[model samples]
Target: MFDQKDLDSIRESRQEWESETLEPFLEKGERKERFATVSNHEVDRLYTPEDVSNIDYDEDLGYPGEPPYTRGPYPTMYRGRTWTMRQFAGFGTAEETNERFHYLINEGQTGLSTAFDMPSLMGIDSDHPMSEGEVGKEGVAVDTLRDMEILFDGIDISKISTSFTINPSAAVIYAMYIALADQQGVPREEVRGTLQNDMLKEFIAQKEWVIPPEPSLDVVTDTVEFAVEETPKFHPISVSGYHIREAGSTAVQEAAFTLADGFAYVEDCLDRGLEIDEFAPLLSFFFNSHNSIFEEVAKFRAARRIYSRVMEEWYGAEADESKRLKFHTQTAGQSLTAQQPLNNIVRVTIQALAAVMGGSQSLHTNSYDEALALPSEEAVRVALRTQQIIADESGAADIVDPMGGSFTIEKLTNEMEAEIMAYIEEIKEMGDGSVRDGVLNGIPQGYFHREIQDASYEYQKRVDSGEEVVVGVNEYTIDEEADPDILKIDPETRNRQLERLKAVKDERDDAAVEEMLEELSEAIDNGENVMPYIIDAVKAYVTMGEIMEVFEDHHGAYQETASLA
Candidate 1:
């Protein structure tokens, strides 16, 4: 970036100024003992050309839409079109959540992101004993195709892109959506959305699973293979770091572990005889944006660069889309506080800005009151307005890679790239050159859990010791007790869901449901792609529980082997 003579001159000048000016000023005023990010990367007082002297402009930070995509994925980025404003909303019965969907869309949201209830996510019906008191508590419940039909009753499927945040039972959800598309007269190729189907992360952090790792992963690969031929526009899998980060990982670990999980899926797909370029382009990612603006930005940038290199070099991907890492960003839920909950709006604003500057394809700004309960209508509208303000009022979106040339940002991106690549290398070595086997081997061994646990413990220790000041949690003490209006699930929500499920069961043809379920069971047993069979069962109104029961009988329930204390 600079000539040797010029660098030498600047180095001498910096030394003289630091000693004569900075040293005296620091001695009088004093400075903090240390400055570091959540990842424990030291922050220098100043950055110069020397900090990024080793970087190659074209090779490392190419123009937008080019290889290694460090600056941004597209040449115009937000200049061409703003990031999609997709809010995650779901609670109570399908009718209720559908109303919220209409509210968000009418409030200027461009996309839909669904959150399933515990019962739906666990692949059980609302009336199941295991689902007692849990139905419609956290997210929306959909037990059969009837619920899905009501969930999108009036919405035109071809017009809006939707994302489903569910795993383990993702294949079931996919079938329901495709069946809905069929009912709506929309061609499968035209329907678009994303499925958060990354199951490896389920074992590592989220702890939501029915079967063990291997078969859970096989079901995921089936969707990927099925999507390539069927739902061409839909993303079959979103390799996620959001849950991993929310479970307490440093930004580096979040990026590394998420990408490794993605690679494992890629390997599994390849082993299934799918071409690299065929399925890779449709694969997407999800990440969390915390309060560390610069660190989070650097993490996103480094991830893009690393993914591009590996896709092309390791997998021999021919298409640029296969190499580019396109991801959706959600503001950190862990950063939200129950006390002084309003402060989360400010936190979300900052995190959302970082995501835009870091080049996210889509963004979800969490409501300030999410720490207490599901967002009220008023709260959710305010959250949507935050994104509108950033896109229209703020000048941050006018340029591509607004922070591309910053010395500190570039330096941090380089360091982040190095650390993330090293972790992937270790995972690969663990499996003796197979990332799929490595992740599979690591899960039962608690390797990933320990890494995340250690980081989480260290961060908690810092907060407890006052080394890290969480504004509402550790510092700025306040004493007040007032109940703010929050969205509450009615005690009758579970009963309503069960009644609806029972009505659907009574109305649908029992013989058709049983025959479809038997066919689905055979598909699973024969090691065949179960997607078509699942779609058939969903269309037959086979309850999610009935379909999942076949799986439990065959695969058995998953029991955690990794011990953590």
Candidate 2:
């Protein structure tokens, strides 16, 4: 970008200006001793062409839709279409959540993102003893195909894309979805959406799993392989960094850990004898967009660049789609403040803008009232409207990679890419050149936990000492405030769900259900792809709990030991 003479002259000029101008100003006053991002990374005062001198426009960041896709994934980006506004919504019974879905769709939401209750996520029937007092507490509870039917009563499965935010039992939910599609006469080839079937991340951060890591990973691989052959348009897995960030990792850790987990899955699928090109295209990612706008945008760019390069250079991927790193962005839920809850609207707006500038394929904006409870209908409307305003009102979407040429952005992007790749290399070495083995090894050994724990601890310390200012949390003092209207789960939700589960059991043919479950158990024990068997069981109205019991009986339950040290 610059000749040696020009670089020397700029360096000399910077020195002179710093001494003559900056020193005098700094002597008078300064806001803080150090300026840092939300992740606590130190920020420099200024950036120039010298900062990004090493970047090659073509090799590092070609045009959108090209290799090393730093600019954006598609050629047109928002010009082709604004990202899908997919608000995450679910609570109480399936019928209730379905009504909320209709409400959101009527308010201009483009896609659906489901949130399952803890019982459903844990693969337990609503009537189970363990599910008492917890049914439909966090999200909707689904016991059988009956619940799924009521969940999507009027929604056309073929027309609208739906994203399921479930892990551990993602295969069960996925089977229910496929069975629904089949019943609706929608071709498996035309079925499109994503499954958050990332169990590795669950072990690393989210702490949600039904079995041990190895078999859980095998199940994830089964979905990928099955999707490649069946539902080609559907993404079998969404490699997630959202929960990792929510667990208090730095932005760099979020990207590194998530991508490492993704590569591990890729390696596992390849080891299973699946072609890279066949499965890579359907693989998608989910990331958190935090308050640090510039850093978030750069992180998204670096992610695309790294993923494209690795797929091409390491995996030898042939198809263009195989190399493209398409992802969904959700505004950081961990950033919202409970004290001044309304302030989160501004935070979400900035985060959503960052995601748009970063070129997210789909987005879910957090409601301002989320810090309090499950977002009220009014709150959800506001959240969806945030995306609408960004797409239609704000000119941010008019240009692709709107922050592309900034010297600061380019420098940060380069640094982030290098740091993430280095972390990945370290993990790869842990497994003797296999990312899958390395992640599995690291999880039990607490490598990832220690790293994220250290980062989280450091950030918390800064906030406690007032080094990092979190509005309404530390810096701003608030006295009292009235509570906003909270979305409450009905007390009768449990009884209703149990009754529905019972009806399904009573009406369905018991012999057929038993037969399907037997076949599913056999398939699992034989180490064959259990997706088809799971689908058969679900179509037979076999309950999620019943299906999961087979897995637990075979693999046993996993009890994680805490590793804070």
Candidate 3:
């Protein structure tokens, strides 16, 4: 940003100021140690033009909506349209979650994010033996197309964008969604939504796999191929780093791991004969907005730059849309505390603010009482209002990339980009020139597991040692009583959901369901795109477990062991 002579002059002036102006304060006791960011990168006390003198602005910090977009994804950004505010809601039953969805939309939410219960995510029906006591406890329970119909009953599929937080059974759920659209008579191209079909992240972070790595990835590829040919506007998979970050990864690891996972999906799609530009634009990412304000903002910027270059150069993607990285951000759930629960509201607000400043396309602000249970309706409203206040009242969204020119942000963004590139290069080398191979190799060997475990351990140690003071966790203690209302799922929600499942089975034609399953098996055996067959089974009201049983039998289950050790 500055000429050589001016940079040299500034550096000289900085040294003089540090000696003459800062030395006296240090001598009088200003503390004698260096500082670092949450990611543990060294931080200078002050940043100036001299700090970013080596940066080439056009090559690194281009205008928004341009090549190697480091500012924002679009030209107008929030000026044209603010980020979509979505609240991740689902619990108890389909009826209950549908009510929450309607409530959120009526309360000014721009999008819907669904959280499926464990059984639904695991491909088990509500009435399954293993699903006892767990049905509809954490999120909405869906077993068949009947549940899918009720889950999105009256909502117009053409207008509202919905995001599903289902992972392992993403394909089955996606088929259910397509069947729902078909039953509603909506055009397939009009069905806009995102599916978290990222099984690689499941292997590396969540460990919720029913099928082993290779086959699980093929299922993901199947969905990508189906979407490319059928649903033009839909995002078949959201490569999520939110769970990875929630699993305790540092900022750099979160970005690197998430991007690597996206790359793996890209490679798999290419193997299926899909061009990079054809399906790449539909790819999306999900990230966690943690407490570190500047670090998170810089990480977002660096992620865009890294992805843009990777697609354009490494993957041979020619289209600008293919090169751009689009993502949804959710405020960090791990930052919330059970003690002095209201403090969580502030934490969420800060994290949400970081996401907005970081130029998120969509955001989900966690409710204050999420640490206690599912968020109360009132608490969810407050969380929605937080995004509204930031958009309309806080003036933060009035300008695009508001911190683009800051010296500290520029330096941090550059440093982060370099570090992420190094990580990607390592992955590429490991995979023999394929990023997918590298992450796949790492998962069985426990590289991601060990790295995240150590990072979490170190962070907990800091909090325990009082070096890192969590507001309500370590430093703040209160004995006074505060009984805030908590959202509780009815214990009978399980029985009601199970009853509904039975009613659907009793009402549907058993012969049709059997026929659909047989056809689906034939399609799978013939290596045909199973989406059409899965849709047929879903429309016939075949249970999720029944469909996944076919896959489980074919691919078998996985047991994680230390291959990388």
Candidate 4:
């Protein structure tokens, strides 16, 4: 924090430099242009001391690892420990993905993030009629506990943490993970990872959902409660803004909406009589690191500041750990272009740098050729090396929050925070009580739809007007044929996976499977915590579809009614 006299002197010097040196150097007939960020917020050409004049250094931008951690959440940050290098991986059967996991680990990846295929994502077994050609297409397919066992066959669960990018059926997946850890002779407390158990974002952005909103929230809260008692190190809900951003929301909307969803989860847990500090610390966040360099950096900084203030002032979270907003960032997959495939390497490197500068706890760099298809072994290595270069070669991480207290960065951080709060108010005004309660009543969905449509329209306008240029997309028109060496899953893998699933089904006791499912259904009907029963069902080799069938019979599927008329 500079003193008043020092601030005045710096401002006077900057004014003289701009008037005498900068202005005269510009072309005489050049007209000033208003630059806007990816979020469509207007950005000024320059920021002076006047922009951050009201900022109290002690209260607003404290030292790293201190309260009001606008600087960073850690004391030494990357200097002490670099951000975790987690490559999001999955393809074909569990065995194939397991080999990929081992390969990445051998390549020096620090964490594991699993991606389930459509069938597994929808809580359907590989043998389901709905899962014909889609098995092992997009991501890996796990039908039962046996698949999970094979997925991490040789990997030590206790030595490495694994993140599951699943929702709607996150509880079931988590139950399988817990059961797997138990089978590995590791205590539940020793197992660590995150479950992207955010159902609200699923309805708002990604439409991969199963149960109705109320029941879904109940199941998610059940996981939260169970995590507090069983696996304290595991994050129950990774409230994700990544999908929302991919769905075309602006950067500010990404921050505010994601945090709003996080608050909704916290409120749900509190309503269930859980203590705020008990479950809030286990709550984590997932956000996007787009191509905007400075804007993305400011977005991450503002997210931490806003979450810290919200937890301390609004929720009265006592523990410092509870107030911390730890987040994982993935480079914008939607931003990748297939035109000039090699250019994507530069794109991902810059995005990965932004995430590191923004103080991410974990990061996943999109492979260069991802826009074409799943990455080849060579492409994934480049992605991993991108992070390694930043961590080792770049001096950006030498100091914690290197951009902290910068005139332009502070100004952008303040502006982004205000924009996010305005969006929150807009959602509240458009709905009944709070936006979360309104979401339960089906009001927030309409608001989200309209907002996304408008944002997309504005983005297209910029592209059409040639105001915003994507290098390979709208600018460089390349007519190259195609790259054929990309990774492709074999058709035989699907056949083998299906055959294995069927063999397991036949070997299991049919009577015990039915009995376990009946007990699971009874637990759901009796309003009992279904985690234990679901774990039991999975252990009995009950297929995912059969388990979901029991729940669907009791709770029914989700039906979204259009209330916009």
Instruction: For residues 25-120, write the lDDT of model 3, one tens digit per residue.
Output: 777774436566555667788899987898889998889999788998999999899999988989989999999888888888888999999998
Instruction: Return the clash pairs for model 1, or none.
Output: none
Measured against the true structure, the TM-scores of the candidates, in listed sequence, are 0.99, 0.98, 0.98, 0.96
TM-score of model number 1: 0.99
Q: Model 1 Cα displacement at 400 (Å)?
A: 0.5
Better candidate number, 2 or 3, judged by lDDT: 2
Better of 1 and 3 by lDDT: 1
Give every collision pair in model 3: 445-564
lDDT value, residue 479 of candidate 2: 88
Q: Write the per-residue lDDT of candidate 1 for residues 318-410, one digit (tens) a residue.
A: 999999999999999998888888888999999999999999999999999988988888888888889999999998999999998899999
Candidate 1 stretches greater than 4 Å from native: none
lDDT of 1 at 169: 89
Model 3 segments beyond 4 Å from truth?
A: 480-483, 562-565
lDDT of 3 at 383: 89
RMSD of each: 1.1, 1.1, 1.5, 2.1
Q: Where does model 2 exceed 4 Å of error? A: none
